[model samples]
Every structure is written in C-alpha cells, then in structure tokens.
Target chain A: MVSRGRPRDMQVDERVLRIAAALMLERGYAGLSIDEVAEQAGAAKTTLYRRWPTKDHLAVAVVARLQADDEIADTGDIRADLVNYLEKIAAGLNRMRAAGHRQGPSAGTVGELVAAAARHEDIGRLTREQYAERNALALALIERARVRGELRADLDAEALFDQMAGALYYRVMITGAPVDRAYAERLVSSALEGNLTCH
Target chain B: MVSRGRPRDMQVDERVLRIAAALMLERGYAGLSIDEVAEQAGAAKTTLYRRWPTKDHLAVAVVARLQADDEIADTGDIRADLVNYLEKIAAGLNRMRAAGHRQGPSAGTVGELVAAAARHEDIGRLTREQYAERNALALALIERARVRGELRADLDAEALFDQMAGALYYRVMITGAPVDRAYAERLVSSALEGNLTCH
Candidate 1:
C-alpha cells in the first residue's frame, strides 16, 4: 500500500535533516551543497531533491528542527516564565551565532537564512507562518498571565514579547552582542518594571 | 594635488551611490551590478572599485548614507524624542520593505544587506561600528533622562533602547508586521510603562 512507506519516510526525513544541520553548522550557508548532502547521506539525488527541492529548503528545515526542540513552560510565575522562554530563544540564537565556524558575532547562518527567505517568496511565507505559530504560543502565555492579574490588564503583550525577543535578535544580528540567560533576566526585569519613576 | 581632487571625488561617490541605490531598490539586490552603477554614474570602473572595492562595500555605503540622514534629536522630553527617533527608523524600514519591487512583507534588500554584512568580515565590523555610534546617541539620551529623574535610577537603559529598536527590526525581518509611527508610539509606551500590575 502507498501508506506502507510512511514510517520509513519519516525516518529518512529525520536522518537527512540531521545530516544537513551538521553540514550547515560546520561549513556555513555558502559551504552547504545539495549534492554533497545527498552523497553524504547515501540517498538518491532525486530523492533528496524531491523532498527538499533546494538547499534553502533543506537549511530551513534543519533550523526549524532546532527550534522545535525549544519548548515553552508556563510555570505560573510570569517573570520566571518569561525569563525561561527568553533564555530558550537566546540559546537558539547563540547556537546560530556560533554556526558555520563563525569567529565573532556576525549573525552567522541566521543572516543568510533571512536573506534566503527574501530571495524565495515561498520560503518567506513559510518562515513567517512558522514564526506566527511560534509567536502565538508565547502570546497565549502572556495572555494567561494578564488574565490572572499578574500583569496589567491594559499591557501591550505583543510589544512586550517583541521587546524581549527583539533585543535578543538585535544583539545577535545588529550589535554583535551576546544573548544569554543573564541578559534574558535583565530584559524581563526591564519589561516588567516600568522605567518611569514611580508616582 | 590630492586635495584638488577631493571635492570631485566626493561628487562622484554621491552620484554612484544614488544610482546604485536606485538600481537596488528598483530591481532588488541581484539586479544591482557594480559595472552598471559605474556606467550610470559616468565614473570609471577603477575609480568605483578603488573607493568601494566590492558590491557589498558600495551597498553598505549606500545604506550608511541613508542612515546618516536620520539624526537623533535630544528634545529634553525623552518620551517625545524617543518616539520621534523611532518613527524615523520605522520610516527607513518601511522604505526598505518596499524596495526592489517587493510585493509583500518580505524584508527585501534589508535582509540582503544583513547577509552581506555576515558574509564579509570587514563589512560586518564596519556596520557594527556605525550602529554603535548611532546607538550611543540614543543611549546618551536615555542616560540624560535617568540622571534628571525622568526615568528610574536602576532602569536598564541599554535594554530599553534595544527593546524599542529591536522591535522595529524584528517586525521588519521576522514578523512581516508593519512598523510605523503608530507602532513606534506603542513600543515606546510599552517600554516606558512596565507590564506588571500596580500594587
């Protein structure tokens, strides 16, 4: 039956993604080659192409797998939850920053992925959709906190989340700064505590 | 004398950048060619290469020029000043979003430039320095506000600034959300007013 290959297909997909991620992390974006991946994976070139279509699609899949490992926890303490979530994000970003044998804070493969998305309309749409799905979980977390009176009823959840996530990205992509658990704590503190002098 | 050619050289740089920017914005990053820019600007290829060295160098120069046009104003009121500066940044991002005949929320040339910076170490260093210099002005504004008691003494100025600027960038590069004057206002309000419920 056609459905008989389902389990084998998923195994192959996992193996292929693992190999591709290893190559991308070691060699960077330009260094990645579809033919080389096919050779290394001992898979048919047609099979690889049929599954991924292009190197961009393969790399994106690799990173998407990395992101899926980061699971959010709602521990009821909004500050702790936010800090934990941001730390997960920072960890992912730090891994990307170190990818491709990057020596400094040059954004590494992450910047290339951003450009890849722009170069391909479908990749752009696909990535945006993935981000939207991921963001909704965090947004829902914030919404829960607000509904429980842990946060201000009128607080801007989207802005709050953006500020925290954006700071991690800005540091990695723009300022070449480090994003870590310490920085995540600082961001959460700043976001939770208003900057203005208390009346 | 070398001094005699200085003014003429400046003129040539301006013309070349203007033409190159037009090409990049109209036809996207791939559409831009150093030879085409040289031809359109009526400058010798050698002169262009001597100054820019590569297409990445020229494109970075073009963006640097655009960023230079956005000057930070210290209007005593940090809220108003921050909002105004962020509005300028949002405007620049919106322009980049619309560049190269992009049809939707794709990052367009901005993502390419980010990749360009990552690909070239020299460009990465140069752009980071430029961003640092620009960020210093904003930091100073936040510091002034802190010193004057407009902000909390223990406030995280760097985090605050990163959050605001990072939100704009995150929206452009990741979320495909619109960043405009209205969104800038919302970002500022969120960063300034903490999200925690009042005791």
Candidate 2:
C-alpha cells in the first residue's frame, strides 16, 4: 500500500532498477538477488531493502518498468488504435519470452512471474490491481468508440477486451506460440468482426 | 511419447489416480507426494513411477480424468454448441480454481501446474499436446458449421476459438473473475457477433 514514488536519491532508484532489469532478463528469475544487484549498482543493502523489501517486490518493480507506459492512442479509428495497443502488449510478452530464454515452447520467465504472484499474496494482489488498471484504460477506449458510433452499442466491451488480451497471454504462456504484431492484427480482426455469417 | 493407457492392473491405476486427486484437492499440490500416495494406495513406488514418471505427470492424469470426455454437441446450432463447450472449459477452470482449498484470489494449484510445465520440458510438451488435442476437437466442430453455412467460410477459426477460451483463462488465472455458464454465454455472443456495428 506504500507509494512507489521516486526516492530522495532518484538516480539511485533508476540505477538499481536498470541493473535489476538487466540481471533478470539475462540470467532469469532465480539469478536475481538484492546483494548482487547492490554490488553491481553501487547501492547499499539498506537502500535496496528500503525500496523493494523483498526479491519478489523488486521483480515487480522491474516488470513495471518493462511495461513502459504505453500511451493508448484514440485516433477515432478504434481498430487501428486497438491494434497498436495490442502490438505494444505483444512486444512486452515477446521481451519476457526472450528473457531467460528457452528451447522449449514455454516462456519460462513469464511463468515465473505468474508463479511469483501466486506464491506471494501481496504480489498477487499488486499484479491484479496493475492488470485492472491497464484494463480500465482499454475499457475506456472502447467506451469512447461506442459513444462515437465506431462500435456496436450492445457490445460486451469487457468480454471483447479480455478475449483480445487473453489470446496473447494464452499463446505466450500455454501454447508457447509467438505473439508478434502480425498476431495482434489477426487477433484484432477476429475480435472486432463477427465470425458468424450475417443472417 | 508413451501411451497413457491401461496396464496389466487397471484397478490399481484408477485407485492411485483417485487417491492422488483427493490428496491434491484436499491437501493441495504441494502436499501430494509419490511416497505418500504409494503408501496410501498400497502400490509399489516403482509402479507409480513407471506409470507417472513424475509428480507432474500424475497431476496431469488427474486433471485429464477430471475433464472426462465432454462430448461436443452440435445440434445444428453453432452458438449453442460453442457455449456448451466453453461452459465445460469454464467448469474445469472453476474446479481447478477451487483446488488446494485456497480462498485467495489466485488459483495457486493452477499456477503451480503452469509453472511446472514451464520448468520441465517433458511436462511442457505433454501439456501442449493435450491442449492441442482438445483444440483440434473444437476446430473440427467449427469446420462442420462452416461447411453448413452457419458461420463465415473465411472466419479465423483458430483466433475465434482462442479468443473465447483465452478470455476464460485470463479471467480465472489473472483477473480472478468467476467463469460460470453466464460468462460463457456472454463470451460466445461477443466472439460470434463481434463488437463492430452492422454496416
């Protein structure tokens, strides 16, 4: 519940997060440690503890940064805007999939993150809130399009958004399939247009 | 690559799986152990290992049995059929969500199973294949409807199926939302009719 704002020493936080991110991406979740990160970032253990408190918390912060506030564009063309937003999400998933890497189909790091959330109740709640926050932005975008007559008035926006986003997650985490921009386009098309033949 | 079929002792396999499922559901995945299940089921350790190979394999068998053979019903109505299938999937997810007896928002056992698949290459491949098998059934059903002119001939079948199923998973795993029959109906409607207004 504490505010994750910038500390008095802003540069220290940035340096620590950058180093932490690099460590996680290069060596995987098990390889990430505060002591090692401190040694590399030239920051004291106390500062790291004061900020992150635990390894899982630190990992959450690192991922938060990776998500880089992808500004959603509402160019009135809902389809194009949705595609762009989904592409950003695909890019993030691809980055995680590439992290710690794998010869297997599974995205190991993404699984770790999901497990981390399950392991720690705090992490689970935090991640859920983060998802809800992101989902809210998307829902609002859909609502705007509906108001402007770009989409169906009776559309189940929540279900629509969930389907689009869920497909990407399912592919990355379960199927071990690729989630690139091309896949995002395909997802957008399938979700926006009905699969049923017009009666 | 071994066939998960019957051995010389059919009853032994069923008994072991039943106990394992109970242990997993009552005590959770962490509490379900080979030694304990072996002792309780009065089966030799070698027998269990030969059949399951690993705890993950046993767990997979338990889930497979729980899923049963949900006979897909196609009464010349694709929407009703898809809803029935999605509801079955949702029921499985809800059962798993209730497993480990955790009242927390996260489905801990489901998360563990996913991570287990990620950690072990064999498990990952096995689960992927199982999912593929299930997906194939759904795809064939869709193709039948398409042939009958019920659905669009050029519909992105894979994407449509993925979106509907993925949304259920995303809700259960990530958002911790309830995925009941009503939700399945909503998903089917959204996916079939889509969000785009009629031209």
Candidate 3:
C-alpha cells in the first residue's frame, strides 16, 4: 500500500505548490497561508509541514519552481547565448511583477521574498544557495565561451555577469521598469559591446 | 525675533536630520521615530512635523543628504569618471551595510527604506525624483564623453548607466555582496570595454 501511495505524495506537493502560488499572486505575501493552502489542496496540515516546514520554505519552493534550471545554453555564439539567458531572467521577473500588487509601482512578491530571506536564517541560506547555484551555471557558460575566444580573455567574468543580471533586478525592484525581451536585448548589447569610443 | 530665527530653524533642521540618521543607522529603521529625534535634538514635535511631514519623509531626507550630490564629476575620462561615481555609491552602500546588521547578511536600513517607499506614495515619489536628478547628472556626464569621442556614439546611455549603477544596488539588496572601490573598478571595466572578444 505504501509503495502504491508514493506517487500521490508528489501529486500532493504539486497541488499544494500550485494552490500556494495562486494564493500568493492573488493577495501578495501577506495572504498566503499554509492552512489555507492545505485546506484548498485537500491535504492535511501534517502533510504540508512534512514538506515545507515553514511558510518561508514553501515560498522558496514556489519561487524555485518558477526559476529556470534549463535556460543556461551553450550556443557557441556568446552574444546570442547571453541574450537568450537574459530573456529567460526577464520573463521570470515579469511573471513575478504580474503576480498581484497591481495597484502600485511595487515589486510586491519579490520585495516580500527578500524581506523573508532576511527574517529567517535557514530560508536566507537556502535561497542564497539557489542563486549561487544558478550563478555558477551562468559563470560556467561564460567560461566556456571565453575558452572558444568568443569573449575577452581577461574579462572580469563575475563583474560582467553581475552587471548584465543586476540591471534586470535593478529595473524590476528600484525603477519599477518592465523587463521585456527588448530590454533584455538592449542590456545584452550594452554589456557585450563596450560603451567606450573606438580608436 | 521670528525673522532673526530663520537661521536657527536651519540649525534645528540640521540637528534633527543628524540625530535621525544616527538613530536609523544605529537602531535600524523601525527604531527611528520623529518624536525621539525631536526630543533628542531638544526640538518640538511640531517643528519636525512642519519640516518633514512624516517619518518616511524624514528618512528620505536623511538618505538624500547622505547621497553624493558631489559624486558626479566630469574629468573627460569616462572610464575614470564612471569609476569614481561608482566608488562613491559603494562607499555609501558599505556604510549602510555596516549600520549594525552584522548579525545577518541583510541590507538592513536600505531594504526597509525601499519598503517604506513602497508603503507611502509621497516617499516613493520624492525618493524616485532624487534618483532621477542624480541619474540626469550622470547621464549628462556620459553624453558629454560620447560627444567628445571619449565613448561610443551608438551606445545605449541609459542601459550603460543602469548596468554600472544597478550592479551596486543588486549586490547590496539581493546578493548580500560587498560593493567596494575594487568592485567599482571592475564594473567600469566590464561596462566600458565590454566582455566581447576582439574580432
């Protein structure tokens, strides 16, 4: 019986995360509750706790699901590859922006998540680890491109990555600007091609 | 007597802001209060209220003063100018980072100020305007360099500015990384020369 019920756990997780994500989007971070999610998902409170441990953890899981683990590509053309990678990041930011908080020029859910990470040590560690892993992948992509002479040999790879990616986050959080494909293209172009005057 | 007291009012404004900034940096944003600052500075609550209108407004003023109205220098060398601008930004971030959130890797007052901006429309507008003004100056500096053939003619000025400045903000707000003089140099290098390999 236990063997037969193994897949159902996965099903429950899927349902809970789906319902939780929806609740968060509809009402912002303040509206999402584990009890509500459990009731809505038709799962017991124990089942939810066994997986997420805390609401922050559940929020992390929801975001993790939204994050792209498959977007880092090795298309050989570093410019195109960087643009493609940034487009995925921009799409994710746009989705977060769309999730409610529709009234003001605020990055609602994303702001709350940052606050949440600050509040809990474990949650902060886990979320930071996730970003680190993603950055590692991006860095590896850059490294490969460099090896093939597609990028500058002495390039400060970390700073390069930070500028391209940071611009997207800055627009989303600080300026309340929309991070679209066009914006992504502009960012990649500005970053890949130097802004200095040629000799 | 009141006509003679105009300069005294300026002194009170300076005192109140100084004490408020200290309190905010020492106790974080939640611990900062108009009443406490007024009392500490031996001023009346009515006086503070007449000046700032709200705590958020006062906080905005404190930050405005701390921000470098003196950082936008045009030395004709775009690379060096940008680096100097970014270094000033980093120094401010480092100060905020040191404002006693040593317990955790959180952006402490900076994050709270951002949330406060979101919570109040007036604060958000005022803060955004301050940034806009600073950005205009920086953009002008970049434009001058471009016109004088110190920078690329076809460059995306806004994107270039965003990439350089946004990286500093991104590190402070999201990545919990230290933005320093060295980091500023790296950012300028990456943005100016770009990451693309020479053809």
Candidate 1, residues A1-199, lDDT tens digits: the string is 5686889888888888888889988988888898998888888889999988888898888999999978889999999999999999999988877787788879988898888888888889999999999999999999999999999999998999999999998898889988999999999999999799888
- Model 3, C-alpha of A157: deviation from truth (Å): 1.4
The fnat scores of all predictions, in order, read 0.77, 0.71, 0.57
So what's the TM-score on candidate 3?
A: 0.88
Query: After superposing candidate 3, which stretches have Cα over 4 Å from the reference?
Result: A1-12, A43-57, A101-104, B1-13, B43-58, B68-70, B101-104
lDDT of 3 at A180: 78
When 1 and 2 are scored with lDDT, the better candidate is 1
How badly does each model clash, as a count of residue pairs?
2, 0, 0
* Segments of candidate 1 deviating more than 4 angstroms: none
Give me the candidate number with maximum lDDT.
1
Lowest lDDT 10-residue stretch of candidate 3 chain B: B96-105
| Native contacts present in candidate 1, fraction | 0.77
Worst 10 residues of 2 chain B by lDDT: B1-10
lDDT of 2 by residue, A1-199 (tens): 7655556479898999999999988877778899999999988999999988889889888998899677788899999999999999988877776676545468677777777777678888988998888889999999999989999999989999999999988887787778878888999998898898887
Tens-place lDDT digits, model 2, residues B20-44: 9999888777788998999999999
lDDT assessment of candidate 1: 0.90
lDDT by residue for model 3 over B1-199, one digit each (tens)?
A: 3586888888988999899989888876677899999999999899899988888789878888888455788888888898898999888876665564445566666766676665566776677777778888989999999999988999899899989888998888777777888999999989999888887
**lDDT by residue (tens digit), candidate 1, B72-147:** 8987898999999999999887777777777789988888888888889999999999999999999999999999
Which runs in model 2 stand beyond 4 Å of their true positions?
A: A1-6, A9-11, A44-54, B1-6, B46-54
